[model samples]
Target: MGKPPLSGIRVVEFAGIGPGPFAGMMLADHGAEVIRIDRTRPGGLSLAIDAKDPLLRSRRSVSLDLKNPDAIAAVRRIVRDADAIIEGFRPGVMERLGLGPDVLLGDNPRLVYGRMTGWGQTGPRAHEPGHDINYVALSGVLHALGRAGEKPTPPINLAGDFGGGAMFLAFGMLAALLHAQRTGEGQVVDAAMTEGSSVLMSMMWGFRAMGRWRDERGTNLLDTAAHFYDTYETSDGKYVSLGAIEPQFYAEFRRVAGLDDAKWDRQMDQGGWPALKDELTALFRTRSRDEWVALFEGHDICFAPVLGFDEARADPHNVARGAFVEAGGVSQPAPAPRYSVSDTVVPQMAGARDDAGLLRELGFGDAEIAALGH
Candidate 1:
């Protein structure tokens, strides 16, 4: 295999929480030399085992006190040779630290400056503090989730923090890198979780416009309202999901499940969904989840048994594909979207490093390194 696609690319990530580290992890996994500049004092929303945190994998760390001018100068020196920089702070925070886009981009015109935030750089709530739930709530995602006549359930932090925030930040930085390569002009990527999450609901918005989706939560086809498209609990107290939306697939599902009632004929009859769903709920409880899985093993009914984290890691298909790997004494997902030619680097644990040695490699003389107290 060839060298990784981003073998020579350098990314400087200002350490923050959530989406910033996740974006850095993606770039590092794909073979970018991601250097994370962490705070000299450690106090933030960090896990107890930060060294084994999957989001911080495949990167090196450099702790620096941003309040010190010498540390700021060192960061500027580092940014001068970097292709991109990622920062996840509220508006003007970087400027306060003297590491804003204007200063860095003025020095390196080819740099891609990526900014991650809950609200965008400019908005009514841009400077306000918030988290994943607030961002998704503002984006109409939270309002559309959960069961009928129930409160909206938060999908943890996936939809807002990682899916909307980190993924878009990574994509924007890569796109801006391409543009910088072509024009030699650096630009800032203002990636906001609110806007990104809103974009994720584009299909739902279109469905609403086309009169295919209802305003009520959990009333849509993809939600939990459809009798043929939902999860059911089994006798073993485990769950299995069914998404047999197509006519042929639904028919196959009914045939396999032994549903000979004439009422199962109309699959899309929303008015009869509640009663049909209750019937399915009662029917599924008659057998164990694994028994249902065995019965549907060779079928195309869009069925899958819901598995927990450990079960997912130990699944046969996951084992065959090497989807999860053991690294740093922890089981975690492997780098995704494989490349035929370029190689992906194995993830490593994040921990303390030789700061002086790294500085020397960056062309800092022994005296200057000592002066910076590295």
Candidate 2:
């Protein structure tokens, strides 16, 4: 295979936290030369507790004191050769530092300026401080996460921080890069976690519009309401998930689960779901998760054991597909969305190489690199 699709792309990432580094990681994973401009000390926007955090993988780091005029000038010089720049900061922070879009883009019109934020650039809450939970809360995501009578459960930081913020920032940068490549005009990509969360609920919105979904939590088709589309605890305290949504799949599931009773015949009776779920709960509890897996392994039933991270990594199917790989002494998820013609590499832990040598490759002279590093 040839080099990764983004092999020749160059990115300059201003280290902040959360989604910014993740975006840069994605760029680097796909063969972009992502150079992270890290700070000398922890400040208001520090993202990682340790400099060796895995999210900073597949990149080189250059520590700079943005408050210093010389460092700021050096960053500008670096940006002149970059295809894109990523930063996750509150509005006007970059402008105040003299590295804002107008300043950088003035010198390099083809630069894709990617900005990551929880509330976006011009919202009423843009200036306020927030995190993943806060951002998803504003989008009704948190409210729809738990059981109908229970308090909403947060899905950690995945939904907002990585899903909404980081993924969107990466996508926006790629799209803007395409535009820059064609038009020679770069623009700011204001990726907001709140808006991205709302976008993720698009199908839910459609269901609500069609009266197929209610506003209450955990009462929808795919939200664990249906007896055939939820996770059930086994006798061994392990769990298995079912997604026998269609009639044919449900039939196969019923046959495999021995649900041949007259009560189970009324599969679409919404009023009987609670009773059906209770019966299934008891039935699933009679067998171990592995027993159920063996019973339905090669059948048409839509079933799978609810494996933990380690178990998932070792699963036969996942192992066969090469879904994960180890690098830099850590077993991490490999780069995704495989390409038939493009090649990708395992990422290394960031900050290992000499920043001076990396800067020299960027066209900086020996003295310039030393001065920048100091």
Top model by lDDT, which number? Answer: 1
Query: How does residue 236 of candidate 1 score in lDDT?
Result: 92
Q: Candidate 2's error at 80, in angstroms?
A: 0.7
Locate the minimum summed-lDDT window of 10 residues in model 2.
42-51
Model 1 Cα lDDT, one tens digit per residue, 94-169: 9999999899998898999999999999978999999999999999999999999999999999989999999999
Stretches of candidate 2 off by over 4 Å are 42-52, 351-353
Model 2 lDDT, residue 122, Cα: 95
lDDT (10s digit) by residue, model 2, range 1-374: 88999988999998887889888888898999998888666442323335356788888877777887878999999999899999998999999999999999998999999999999999689999999999999998888898768888999998899998899999999999999989999999999999998889999999999999989887888787888889999999999999888899999888877888889888878788889999999999999999999999998878999999999989999888788777766777888878899988677876454667777777778887666644
Compute each candidate's TM-score over C-alphas: 0.97, 0.96
lDDT score at residue 116, model 2, on the 0-100 scale: 94
Give model 1's TM-score versus the native structure. 0.97
